[model samples]
Target: MKYDFDEVIDRHNTFSMKWDCREIHVILGITPRFDEDTIPIHTADMDFRCCEPIQRALRAVTDHNIYGYTGVFPGGYGQTYYDAVIGWFKRRHDWDIKAEEIVYANGTMEAIRSCIEAFTEPGDGIMITRPVYTPFTGTILKTRREVVNSPLVDREGNGFYEVDYEDFEAKAALPSTKMFLLCSPQNPTGRIFTDEELLKMAEICRRHDVLIVADEIHGDLIRRGNVFHPIAKVAGPEGIITCTALNKTFNIAGLQATNIVIQDPALLDTYRKNANFVLPNPFTAAATVAAYNEGEEWLEQLIDYLDDNIDFVIDFFREHMPKVKIRRPEGTYILWMDFRDYGLTGDEIRERIYEKANVMLESGPQFDPERGEGFERMCVPTRRSLLKEALERIAAQFPEG
Candidate 1:
């Protein structure tokens, strides 16, 4: 209650891709069948106001007004940003990492793309889950490597997605499959992976010599009762590059910053060599340092608000939309709602809901082709009142039986 979860902030006219993207709004009108303006909850960006401390720091940069060419890594934002992540790993996760092991990049997306390019050759194979963050597929394909799918299998009402271990090992062992991207506190599902699961995954990738790219970007967002483990902590640190950022946790994603931690110096060097594609600007550093250093209190408050939103969502589904099921995610503000019982195709459900209520949600198909069909990702970082209103609208879209 300390943070205002019911507060509404306007994101339109702010150059927000989620809010201001006219093209997507038009396309959405086709499927989700929205009017010119819709309540968009489809994209991953948070609707909350930017963390105040980060805004102050960016303002400080503007006041300086130098705006010259900036150096990458080991300066300004890089120095303090590195310390913050190191502190975070030690404080929250109980994992200690050397500052030298951490590499800087524009963001996790760019870092993953560079990792694919650096770790594998053309025609090599990469493995990732479908119904996953869409960029992972394109990043690997851009490397001219084949992407192998080990779709996350949902069994009955388990309310979680699991990889086919046999298929994973087989693909990893192939001479072609050279890397595997793991999204922990996974998006959509919000499942904080078990230690046993991460260990098994790391072992298979290790045995097959496939580099492990663990995207623990949501690690900092884990709830109080659950623990979010970094894969490298259990995997014993060989050929593992950990990609994470403060953007998701603090809702400062536009800061354009993230860290890539690789234990092996040689591999880290090669990754840096291949990562010349995008250089982060100074504001990225300014906002990042501000986030890591002074943003903890804000983050804690945000977490509490999100938990309330989660509770509200569950209540709404149970009372008004009983056909949809949720897993009560342990981390990540994203929720994966299962509507398989309704027997509507993901697209059908999405289109119908949007057409009826003007509420936009991430349809399941974007995560993967098969497993994603029954689910939708709803981000709960916005105002609880708005989230409630949106869910009610979505439910009203379904005609009473």
Candidate 2:
């Protein structure tokens, strides 16, 4: 309990997309039925304060006030940030890493989009597991590449989304399939792929000469007892392209800093060439270095608090909202709650929350084009008091048919 995670901070008037339902509604072409007073749990971003180390780093950069072009490869703290990544892998997963193998990114999603641009040509097949982060699908499709969804299977009671290996292998086996975008500690159902699963996936990709674009963005936020096995470690010598960012782990999403690790030299060369003028965000870079170097203690505390929040929420649902089934995620603060038991469509759920509850949550239909229709993703990173209040708002509208 070194840090008080329950500190309530005012996020309104800060231009946060989460707090403004009207802004989202206007942009997305939906009518804003919810008022300005609604509490939003739609955005994937956290509500925690930035770590002191990150704030210091950003402040140091602003202290200079020289916001100009920065193209230098060896920017301030680049070496330190790289070193921190190496140490993190060593301490957490016992994996050895070399500094030269990784490259910086504005963000994981941007890196993923650039990877699509760099590694493959237009019309190439970029495979992904559905019920994934929404932007991932668009990242591929936006690049003029095809989004081939190898949807994950949820065996009525297993909770986490499991892939059909035969289907995955079949997709990789295709001549058009060039890359597989794997979301570890996956969004929505929050399935952390085991080492055995990684190996099996690696085997398929390797045999088919397909590249694996592993998005381990939520890797560091993993829960206890669940081991996050990085795909590159098991993909033989041709390790998968890893896309990770410090934004999610440290609640610095606005900082937009990430590291894309490509073990193969040829692939690395291709990606670096693709992102010709793209530079690692300067302020973001500085903050990432500081956070990685001095923010481990903060991270440990944050994870512990989040774990408690996860447990509390799970218990709350089991007791008061038993109709809403949640698959306890092994990672990430975003909890995927299945509301199919209520027999409400996605639109119905959205309307009910906005009209009756005054609470806004992310509709599942946005994640996977299939099962996303009947689910909702709730972010549990805010203060427990706020969460309790939001749930109470919904409780007032309980027993809705």
Candidate 2 is scored at a TM of 0.94
| lDDT tens per residue, model 1, 228-296 | 899889767888889978778777677767878888777878886776745567788777777777787
lDDT of 2: 0.79
Clashes of 2: 2
Clashing pairs in 2: 364-372, 365-372
lDDT of 1 at 66: 82
Candidate 1 residue runs with Cα over 4 Å from true position = 25-37, 72-78
Q: Which stretches of candidate 2 lie over 4 Å from their true place?
A: 29-31, 71-77, 236-239
Among all windows of ten consecutive residues in candidate 1, which has the lowest summed lDDT?
28-37
Query: How do all models score by TM-score?
Result: 0.93, 0.94
C-alpha displacement of 82 in model 2, angstroms? 2.3
